[model samples]
Target: MTIQKTISLRPYPRGFHLITSIIEMQLAEIRQIKAGILHVFIQHTSAGLTINENADPTVRKDFETFINDLIPEGYAKFIHNYEGDDDMPAHIKSSFFGNSLQIPITDGKLNLGTWQGIYLCEFRNQGGPRNIILTAMGA
Candidate 1:
């Protein structure tokens, strides 16, 4: 069996946020898939998706710091400044982290590591509500 749904997340600040509960809450259909794969695709360029240590808030904060340092804003080298100083850097960060994730599903639940969780890497200061497409496929 296969199921797909588009989910929208509440607006978050410019940082990395854990959204595992939000996704599970909205995608209740995943409970029906005994064994399968869940593909999550974010629908935005200034923000992206990833999975990492969910048990530590510092990890998320460090992610933001590291990314910002790696792709600092106001470089004066980016031509896509129509949005703002964060525009170009946001796009670069999005590409670096990617916009999608594929996780294994077992026993009607995501087979994530004990400390792993999905993340929404909001690069822009006010990257409004983000959308994600969840597709689950299995028996």
Candidate 2:
């Protein structure tokens, strides 16, 4: 049989980026399921998920810079600005990326690449609590 669990995270950021509770959720799921696959997802339009190098802080910084460069703000071409300046941009970044990821499970553990770690990408610029939904399913 398979079971699913949902976890939430309150990220304090407006356009600040952060790597969220994927590791902790995965660890807990592994303890419950003897063997199977794990799927982690974020239920937000302006947020995303990715697997990246968590060892070096610079890596994350570089990524933030790169993402910002890819989608610079203050564009008169944007239409969705109801939330704020960062709102439309956040949606763009999320569109460029994704909202979910699936990891393989083996021997009651997630089989991830040595340098691969799950992260929740926040594109909002204001520092406030953000919600993230994690769902895990396995036998």
Candidate 3:
């Protein structure tokens, strides 16, 4: 069986945020899925998705710091600046982390590790609500 749904997450600050619970809440149908895979894809170029530490807040904060430092805003070389200084850098950050993620499903639930969680990698300083398409496939 296969299922797909698009969800909109509330606007979040420019940072990596744990959205595992929000994603799980949208997957009520997954409880019937004994074994499967969940594909989460972000619809915007300025934002992305990832999986990482869910236990500590520092991890997420560190992610924002590291990526921002690595890809600072307002680089004089960027050509896509109509959206603002964060435009080009956001797209670059999105590519590094990616726009989608695949997670194994087992026993009707996400088979994530104890500290693993889904992350909404919001790169734009004022990114609005982001849309994510969730696709689950299995028997």
Candidate 4:
């Protein structure tokens, strides 16, 4: 069986956000998937996705702090500053984190670890609503 859908998330601030609940709310179709893989892909190049700690908010904050220090906005060398100083750095951060994630599905539900959850790495200050494409495939 296979199911695919595109979902839009309300805009979040420039930080990492846990979106597992949101994704789970939209998985009614996958309730019958039995055993499968859920492939989540972000539509924007400046924003990306990952699976990480969800119980601690500080972990998300630390991610933002570290990535920002590594790729601070407004470096003199970036040539793709058409959008803003955050644009190029956002792309670079997105590359570092990546744009897609795959989670195992068992018994019609996500098989995530105790601390694992989906993260929307909003790279830009005003990245606006992000789009994510979800695909589930299995026997």
Tens-digit lDDT string for candidate 4 (18-137): 999999997678789889999999999999999999999999999999999999999999999999999999999999999999999999999999999999999999999999999999
* lDDT, candidates in the order shown: 0.94, 0.69, 0.93, 0.94
lDDT of residue 61 for candidate 4: 90
TM-score of each: 0.98, 0.83, 0.97, 0.98
lDDT of 2 by residue, 1-139 (tens): 3646655566645432445344565346576666677777677888777788867668777877888888878788998899988888898898887888888777667777787777777887762454455445566
TM-score of 1: 0.98
Instruction: Pick out the ten consecutive residues of candidate 2 with the lowest summed lDDT.
Output: 13-22
Model 1, which residues run further than 4 Å from truth? Answer: none
> What's the best-to-worst order under lDDT?
4, 1, 3, 2
Which pairs of residues collide in candidate 4? none
Q: How accurate is candidate 1 locally (lDDT)?
A: 0.94
Shift of residue 13 alpha carbon in model 4, Å: 0.9
- Across 1-139, the per-residue lDDT of candidate 3 in tens digits comes to 8999999999999899999999999988998899999999999999999899999999998999899899998788899999899999999999999999999999889999999999999998899999999999887
lDDT score, residue 96, model 4? 96
| Residue 10, candidate 2: C-alpha displacement in angstroms | 1.9
Is candidate 3 or 4 superior in lDDT? 4
Give the residue spans of candidate 4 off by over 4 A. none
